[model samples]
Target: MVAPMSVWPWGNLGAFKYLLFGPFLAQVLYSRMGEDTAKSSWCLHLLIIWGLRLFIHLLLGSFGNMLFLNQTRRIIKQGVDFKQIDREWDWDNFLILQAFVAFMAYYIFPSLADLPLWNTRGLITVLVLHIGASEPLYYWVHRCFHGKYLFTNYHSLHHESAVPQPVTAGHATFLEHLILTAIAGIPILGSNWLGHGSLSLVCGYLVVFDVLRCLGHCNVEFIPYRIFERLPFLRYLIYTPTYHSLHHTDLDTNFCLFMPLFDAVGNTLNSKSWQLQKELNSGCGNYRRDIPDFVFLAHVVDLSSSMHAPFVFRSLASLPYATRLFLLPFLPIPFVVMLAMWAWAKTFVISFYNLRGRLHQTWAVPRFGFQYFLPFAAAGINKQIEEAILDADKLGVKVISLAALNKNEALNGGGTMFVNKHPDLKVCVVHGNTLTAAVILDDVPKDVTEVFLTGATSKLGRAIALYLCRRRVRVLMLTLSTERFEKIKKEAPADCQNYLVQVTKYQAARTCKTWIVGKWITPREQSWAPPGTHFHQFVVPPILSFRRDCTYGDLAAMRLPHDVQGLGSCEYTMDRGVVHACHAGGVVHLLEGWTHHEVGAIDVDRIDLVWNAALKHGFKSVSAPRTTSSSKSNFIS
Candidate 1:
């Protein structure tokens, strides 16, 4: 339970806490517009500090994620869960509070407004004051917080994140942070009082402090063991992530803030700290490095959606993906990252989670979804997919599922080329289009005897057509290619062959209330459907909702089983704990221990079987929030 003293006055404000800075921001703007430029730097200083703290926190988190992916220098093996992400979501609250404190300090000591840009002596002053005053002051105060009274009320909130990330360093209760801000301000304030202070000194000292704090909590070992081995006394001067991690795990040892020297002097240092540091540095620690049972091969949807990757923004990634106006300024960064990936073109693991004691990971091809449509990109995209599949095969992965574009017919014949090329491979290559078809088919109402279908020549379209025909449901297959339509119709049983009809015009489906869109459709084409027509889509970048009288279904998706753990990030635009049907399809294959390759043509006969397996495994169909109870039951049941 949170103690009354620890609760922030404006804690409930959340994002609205920025409103507190409005007065300060307005002052800066007014100063910039008028002749009063003295307070401008000071006001801007507060804003810049907040921005820098946020930047470094995100930067370190991104770097840590990259290390986790490369699997070399990560100190902790466990991924951050949704709870930790949400807990650290308001990490910048302290920065905003600190700005208020600084404003009060400046009001009391107006001389601070006239500081020099640089002071050589200020560096020495900051170093001496921080070491002599701040370090020991923090050590004793930190130990006291661990006592029963404070631990339960205040300190425990910060310690909640066992496997800490960069943002974790700033996640503390209001009272705990109030004490910390004083400890951090000592050196800078001392330097100012001693007449050795400079703007550069304050900025430089704070930035370094933020960097080291983030580094210690980053859960990644970066300091080489050789550094401590070369100079034995250095271990006591500076602490590593391993040393600080022990403080969280052991709860009684390694209590020094950044310098282990105080811990040693206080006799609170963990004896195992040096050994664990050695083990992590040597890359043979107890950290988990197990091979995943299944891999979901996915690609970036576009420049904007790319930022939804787990490494970019933990808070944004935790929710379903959508374009945010604030993210537009950072679009160029993703463009640069995309170009960098293109230069180093390859597949890399982006995120992973565990379910039912099985490891599953999502791997990304460097190419974006739009690139798949470029004529020149087809070969490179195929090559990356092939390499990912081969690597999974070599790693003894039980199954690898291809994303929509990866299994495009024009790219690699729905992944048939990879399976046929390596016919003897043990790993199951799955397109997962069977489950995609099943999900779309399940959404159709039972009484609907006739349905309109688009993209009839594609793999999913073909499977859907054949499956519906077998049910004696008349399928209006929209395609210009009669030859392709005839081929799909011939695959159906002789008795159901008459259920499939070829149509080249949207006018043919004017009366059909159920429309399955396997391809993109224009607003004009969508208008051809009758009023109240419900559109079920399997297309990437789903079609627009144009008619108020009609409802549109979301892309095929399923909520993961209740047992899923460490699934902090959403899959693309899917909701938390929900994934595209293709991804779930691959997982079902792994759980069912199916050894057969699910590539090439989707088995129409296995639609019900796969759907049943998904249901048996507790996977539920995901319906749009706007779907009414009557509409939801028609699809979900």
Candidate 2:
């Protein structure tokens, strides 16, 4: 069998007083039954007044309780943590006792005796004094409660509800509540004795103050700071929902009732509270500081010292108006010095070595001078390299190639080959992949003259062309196939195409020659030849011969007579545009005249030697046609 819990009738007596007597007294007072009463009659009149106030407060409290209960039910149904709704009414009796004692001491005692301190003038003085004195007293005593000695004994009960509910406002040890109430009453007693005021005034002040205190500690957000803080006078002195809510949550600072000035002046304000408020208002997650050290200091400081002494002292003697006026003229000197230092540092102090390292490691080196033999490949290779070379070339424009050349060997045996072979041809190569294009382009030097494309159409090539075109870069296409060449030309926007054409024309005029290589002929297929022995030639100056078996090296090896110097010069000039010509014995022929006459022949070996020499001279290798293995086998056979 389970044991039965003992019942205490007194436990429910306070609740009974609230429910039964509250409404009856409210009706009597609201009807103004004791407005013209003497001091002797005032006690009975106040009983009616307090009863009415309590009645209305309980009515609201009941409604609030119903709302909270409904919310709790909903929360439970939604599977919210039950501990969030944890409630304990253990301190209700103590709070009731405190309220009873305050009512007797402040409202009831003098009513019975018409004491000089109980008059209207005395009450007014007490109300005014209470406003000024109660706050500082509460602040110091509250600070003491938080001290090491009192916290564990008296203050811990209040802190038991870390997330305080409305009922938890006055929940504390009986002695603790009595001590605080007595401290709060000191101002009223002292002020009444100093300048006696009215009972109505005193009662009104207590009623309003208690209401505010209770509402401030209420769990429900009735008085939103957003609305209340906007009021002019209320914004200054009265505490808002936020102010008191922070006191409960923070358990420090905001100890004063009427204003925050005391906290600010005392330097005991919880800096974290201000930071939290800022973060909450700004919707920023940037609160860095946690606990404020001053809160602990506030706890140790003696209450007498804190309450009696002014928190902040103002003294004009520290720095007179004359001193300020004297210093005003020199302000510009510091400003001028700072400005000059900033300008100098910005212009000359910063080091380029770090930038150079970043460029070398992360950014692709700009290809400035062209080398025909080496090719570079990487992400955004075409665009980055082209931009870099163009930015680097000032005197003459340089073009970039879509070729793979290792960074380590690029200067000696890579993209530099094109510049070395054709000293007059300015070009460079930038290496990158799709991921690196943006970085490479961003860091590309400003001297590159042009960007050139080789091989098939690729994203990198298109990106490079697009980037250069956007930056008003001179972009040139040097591929072997008319299919891709025409596609690129057509795909390019009208403005970009026009720009590219203008750049090409300008480059051609400057070099005095332009070569259109590979499959980009007027009638595309006209250049395509069948496999096997066939004559390949071009029409040029009369100095060179169009032969099926002639090479450039054979022409050089011929050591033509001195009288034929004009023919050699003509041949050299024609070779600039003549990209390739195949001969019957694997030779390259230099065709001459308007009809491409066979005037001279060069063997394959001689052609190879000349190409090798050009390679040695730094001429990048042009992409050759990939012949089928069957065709090569048949040629060998």
Candidate 3:
């Protein structure tokens, strides 16, 4: 619980808090545009300081979240939650607000503003003042904040996050940050008052401060213990992540800022800090992390959406992904990384979470959605996916599900090639389309006697057509190939065969009020559907809602079990706690511990079986709001 005094003045401004620098930015732009380019340098300096503060957090935060990193030695075993993320959403507001103060300081003290770019004396002065005055000041002030009255009113908010991450370093109350600002400013301002200040000195001090702060809270012990082994006294000179984690767990010890020497002097240092650091550093190499029981083999949707990975941005990954204006500047970084992945051509872990004590992970095939469409990229993509499956088999993974384009029919025959070639494999390969088909079919009204279906020759389309035909519903399957249509019709019972009718044009559905679209359609094609027609879709990149009068169903999806934990990232465009039907299918497979592989053609007989299994395991269908009619079809416009 946050005390009333701990609340910030901005009161959870979120991303909009960056606008606090707008007035300073406008002045910088105006000065740069006019004759006084010299005055713009200080403004630019302040902006760079602000930017570096944010960049350091992102760099360390993303690095710590990478599963390939030394995760075995992670301080906290649990994942971050929405509450902690929301609390730290405005973590950088302090830097922006302080920069505004610095901007005013430039005008008040012309000597401080017109300093040289570099000065050896200024650097020396800052290092001396930081060690001699600033460090001691911060250590004592920090200990004072832990006192009962101060802790309850101001310090408890920072301590709310027991499982710390990079941003947790800045997650403090306004009054606490005001004191921190003074601690950080003393060395630089003291240097300026002594006539040795320089722009490089301020920049260097701020960068080093952020680096140390992020390192202590990053949760992952990145620094090697070999250095301290070589020089034992250096342990007091520098503190590791393990050192700081003990402080959060045991609030009475290890309260120094960046150095353990101060804590030692104050008699508040934890005795086990060095011993635990050695244990963690050795464990990183001596032991392996826990293997996941389930893996979701996924692919990148697009260039822009690639940055929505958990490692990249925690806040952005928590919500349904969209193209944001603020994210445009960061595109070049992912572009370079994308080219490297394309060249490497391997499957890598993206993120993971736990459900009912079983570990579930998501791994990517290092290819984008467009690359899957390219004729030349199919073989390489399949090879990577096949290797991942084989690796999981060796590692004793119970179930591995192919998601999105990984299960594309033309690419690898819905993962049939791998399963067939490795017939003796232990791992259960799942296409997860059975549950996907069930979710779509469940939306069809029981009273409806006829429906128009597009892309009827596709995998999912064929199953829906056959299932409905068994119930005596007339299925107008639109396809150019009569031969393919007959193949699916022949699979149905002899009595139900006549219920499947072949139609090649949208004009044939002019009077149809129920349309199931498995393929993309334009406004002109959609015009064929009669008014009040509910368009049930299984299409990728779902069709546009050109007609407001017509209702459209969302792609098949299901809500995850309530027992799910550490689910910090959204699955593509799904909302929090919801997953695509294919993803839910994988979860159901794991929970049921089914032994057989779920690959190749979806079994129409097992559609109800899988749907019932999903419900039995507490997964619910993701349905939109509906207006009831006499027909009883549930859909929204």
Candidate 4:
């Protein structure tokens, strides 16, 4: 018969201390505890502290629903929808089960707790070894559970709540929870059995560590990164709020527990995704990745040939109506220019290349225009031409070559025209017909950066653009005709301008590239505002700089300065005492101190000015008032 271990007479007192007094003592000790003293007393002290912390959290957790409900109500009233605040009792049950399993596995399993390995000296060594061993062990086991077979059956439940709530931490199948707990606990038990430490020390370490784990999973935002991340060694040793938040947001990243170092080393950390989520949560405008190719392709196929198609159906649906009106007219311009240039490049540029047979020569044109396309269309195209020309002074070869046939046909047209326009533009335009341009590209001055073709279709231009992208040449495709420009803009990829370079017939490609690189063109130049009015007045502080009494043209010319951080949306408001300009999202009041003056509820002239200002600030379309939905009202109320 197994001998039953009797509870200590002071066990209840110890429990009380563990659940209450210990944490308070730990807080006090945190300030005064010397490094050696802290390390020496870690097991005894942490056992008491963690016991108390865990008990307090569990005690408070009984009312966790009420707390969440209150928070939900507050958030709803603050404009966030109630539906967005996920309230699921299922998650609570899951978290409880996970905790229960972890406790049972750590405390109950005799093979682990009674291991002969951990009967050694010192609490700090035991704690560190336990933690170091637990992480890698847990990682591998967790990864195995994510395997196709196990994932479908057990792991899927945990993943159901991608935007994990506080209650989501422990939500898993009982079996899955048991498996995970065992995976975490078995290593510590094995470490102890290996003669590394004592069971008492292990228990104390487990208690404190588990309490911190629960606190980390809790949605309490009291301990922010700004405070905790500033700490010297603590930043690296312990998990911070931001670390777990990223795990919840992006399931694939930040898999390591306790510290991010392992995840960083393993290349599983996603800092960018985490940063993006933080920005979104802070009410910085909705940030989404540029539309995926398949989605963009769907839009193009569905809305092709319709003028309203580009305006009515696009990722720009989020823009204000005024902004839409201002920007929509220009949407078709890039497409049309792209198409015409494609035609010109195929007909003339490739033909010139084929006729010359001197495909090795480099061409130079102004740095701007469909340079992004050169990589894919032409094999052996020099990649360095695009990189070296970061500024006018650093500009390299002025001429580039075009392949006869390649994948993206769109480039064959516009790209050709863009290259041909440069005075020193060289062409290696190839022709299958045996009839080609007599110009040997090498014979042309090395100053040629642009190339033109009269035969390529939009398809060919796309090929050239893709080719240039591979070679890293920033080729610009230009069109002389407005109609054609619109077609090309509509047909071209969203990143085409950045890569392929699109220009109107009127603008000099070389001059345009120079201006763009130099940032010389003012917002008024780029914007569709009326001439003469200064857009500079609208250019306000860090968020937006707007010119006062600026015409649409003036607003257009006002490019966002390079130094501005976190640029989102620019807004113009003509409300109250003076024409007020503000950025959208954050609350900015006019008065120095509190005076009951709402900027939105100003004079009618101010309202008109605000509308004009929004237009000047580049709002695409304003949202029309909708009949208040019951759901929306409930959420807001």
TM-score of each: 0.95, 0.33, 0.92, 0.30
TM-score, candidate 1, is: 0.95
C-alpha RMSD in Å of predicted model 1 compared with the true structure: 4.0
- Whichever of 1 and 4 has more TM-score, that candidate is 1
CA lDDT scores, all candidates in order: 0.86, 0.36, 0.84, 0.34
Cand. 1 Cα-lDDT:
0.86
- Scanning candidate 3 in windows of ten residues, the lowest lDDT window is 628-637
Q: What is residue 282's positional error in candidate 2, in angstroms?
A: 9.0
In candidate 1, residue 475 scores what lDDT? 97
Best by lDDT: 1
| Total backbone clashes of candidate 3, pairs 3 or more residues apart or in separate chains | 0
The C-alpha local distance difference test score for the whole of candidate 4 amounts to 0.34
Better of 1 and 2 by lDDT: 1
Q: lDDT tens digits, residues 519-593, model 1?
A: 999999999999988999999988888888899998999999998877888887777788999999999999999
- Give the TM-score (vs. native) of candidate 2: 0.33
By TM-score, the best candidate is 1
Q: After superposition, how far is residue 140 of candidate 2 from its true place, in Å?
A: 0.5
Candidate 3 backbone collisions, by pair: none
Which residues of candidate 1, in runs, are more than 4 Å off? 32-36, 67-70, 625-637
